[model samples]
Target: MSHSTKNSHLSTTVANLKPSGIRRFFDLAANMDNVISLGVGEPDFVTPWNVIEASYHSLEQGYTAYTANAGMIELRQEISNYLKHRYFVDYNPDNQVIVTVGASQGIDLALRALINPGEEVIVIEPGFVSYAPAVTLAGGDPIIINTKPEHEFKLQPEQIEDAISEKTKAIILCSPNNPTGSVLTKEELIKIAAVIEKHDLIVLSDEIYAELTYDEDFTSFAFIKGMKERTILISGFSKAFAMTGWRLGYATGPREIIEAMVKIHQYTMMCAPTMAQHGALEALKNGQKSVLDMKKSYRQRRNFVVNSLKEMGLDCHLPGGAFYVFPSIKSTGLSSEEFAEQLLRKERVAVVPGNVFGSTGEGYIRCSYAASLKQLDEAMKRIKKFINEL
Candidate 1:
């Protein structure tokens, strides 16, 4: 095929899509032998027996048909109730929630629904990689504001205020953040709330890790004063309940925004999996104790990995939540990508480079603790050897 002919059929939008840096690095690590990957942000535990049982039961009951575009009413109601019980936020199942294919889909739907062409949206740097591209795909421009390491990679009120303009349409707030694992405290969220409220901007709040807070209670943006009304709360069973493969997640917000999201959802994906919805509903009905169990283990693993990193001469933020430790690699005078690649290739320890997330991630690497303590110990040993050889 000629080069011009091969390119002629591609959508200009997708033709220009940059492949995910995370996936690119991951692919490299995957081919390497004897690699102990601490790179993926996924739980190592099996999905709880109860949740698995629920899915099986749903399948047995022949609940495999396509669900309503917004999702099953029962799951939506359960999600609404769970949010109120877990975060103390009022939500109407009928009008406030839409189940989707994991929190990723929820994020995409929110971006597509809320952003207008060429409008700018603010994303905190050293954050998740998906937010910017999703906004860009929606024909919106992404404005990234770098969060300071001194501030623990937090999105400051001043940063948000300074980033705002007449063209700004939305902002992404990820608490218990990926890569950094920092949780936004209530007071911190209140500061952000003030900024968004002042500008009347919509908030695409990704709280998928909401149930994994350590050292402090989880704070939902939906619970912040004046934020719930304007915030699209994206969450799922992935982090909290080890249900990543289930591909069930949801977003809750104003009815108008949700309806708009459903418009996109109906055209792209008719509905999330029916079996997953049923299982998710059962999870909402019976998964509280499981959440606590996982969180407890994660907290223990967090302490083990963070302390080991410090002992290995790495400066790491003692992240309050999520299952990751973002450690500085500046002393090695290596870029984050180089550090990650060298560690994986030489020491067989695979961690994600900070630069994979955003420019602010330049000198850090993210190590996920969502593995066994034994695995973590081995990973730490390999990492130590990798550092010592420098």
Candidate 2:
């Protein structure tokens, strides 16, 4: 019953995991007055009205029960069709697709299903905070490949080749990546695919921000000629459809891998929420315009944030997609954590310290441009003032 005794009862894997740096700053901002948060990666838009109505309608029709383990057949078909139409990838809805609680769950499922004890999964860094830990919890050692700012944080094929070893089994990739907003182009992917093919490795491609790319066509890794069999495509309605609270996402890949993930899902999660599934169905059917409109707004915000940061002497990359801009704060001679904390305390503006994503992020901070233009303008002014005073 003692504190130390309780700690001993916890799994070493769970106990040793560091708390999310994003949430720590979010909590600090939550306790402060008049704080403008540019930390969280969630969209500022509400879910489309038709999606909301459909979810409510599902309940009225006495559909308040569990769906099939893989999800409703119609929703799966739509997911299949959407991918084929939008990104030119084909998946058999019957066995190749699974509706998940979120893309986060899809990541967890893929890792658990693919990894054996002591195997290694390559994780590209300045990446999602969950990735390395998820590999660890799945009993795989995470081999980190740190992408650099000089290269715009894009992962190179040589980097992948350098990290692979006899025990390496998989890799996690995010285009329009979280925190960095750096999108890998099709050419870049073709090169990375070569390395994956050479190693005969599986890839967990997180495309949650696929719809948010501003200046280029979004390419699915599975759409590449020979990569589909080795790629598990994970995506959701959270970013594009503005449905974060819905907690609905899905994955599609080779039937065998999907079957393995579904086996775990049935025992652990059973199925994704029924109403959220219904809402997601409506989103895929009628949410294109809303997605485009939101993408436009986010694109504008991305430009504003990048310009503002550069004007104030910060080194910022012009993000090609997603609602985040990772700007280097090293010029200010402050650590990422120190800059984030001081800005929150002095300017009442909340941003996440980039080091939490990985060591490569140590001198930067991630600022989400998902807020209203007015709020972004004000946050920029406060940030400028804070830098000037320092």
Best by TM-score: 2
lDDT tens per residue, model 1, 35-148: 888988889988888888998998998888998899999999999888898799988888789999999999999999988899999998898989998998999999999998
Estimate, for each residue in 1-390, the C-alpha lDDT of model 2 and write its tens digit: 232436387877777777787899988999999999999889988899999999999999999999999999999999999999999999999999999999999999999999999999999999999999999999999999999999999999999989999999999999989989999999999999998999999999999999999989999999887999999999998999999999999999999999999999999999999999999999999999999999989988889889999999999989888899999999999999999999999999999999999999999999999999999999999999999999
Candidate 1: residue 330 lDDT (0-100): 96
Please, what is the TM-score per model?
Answer: 0.97, 0.98
lDDT to native, each model: 0.90, 0.94
Report how far off residue 347 is in candidate 2 (Å): 0.4
- Backbone clash count for every predicted candidate, in the order shown: 0, 0
Q: How many Å off is the CA of 385 in candidate 2?
A: 0.2
lDDT over C-alpha atoms for residue 204 of model 2? 96
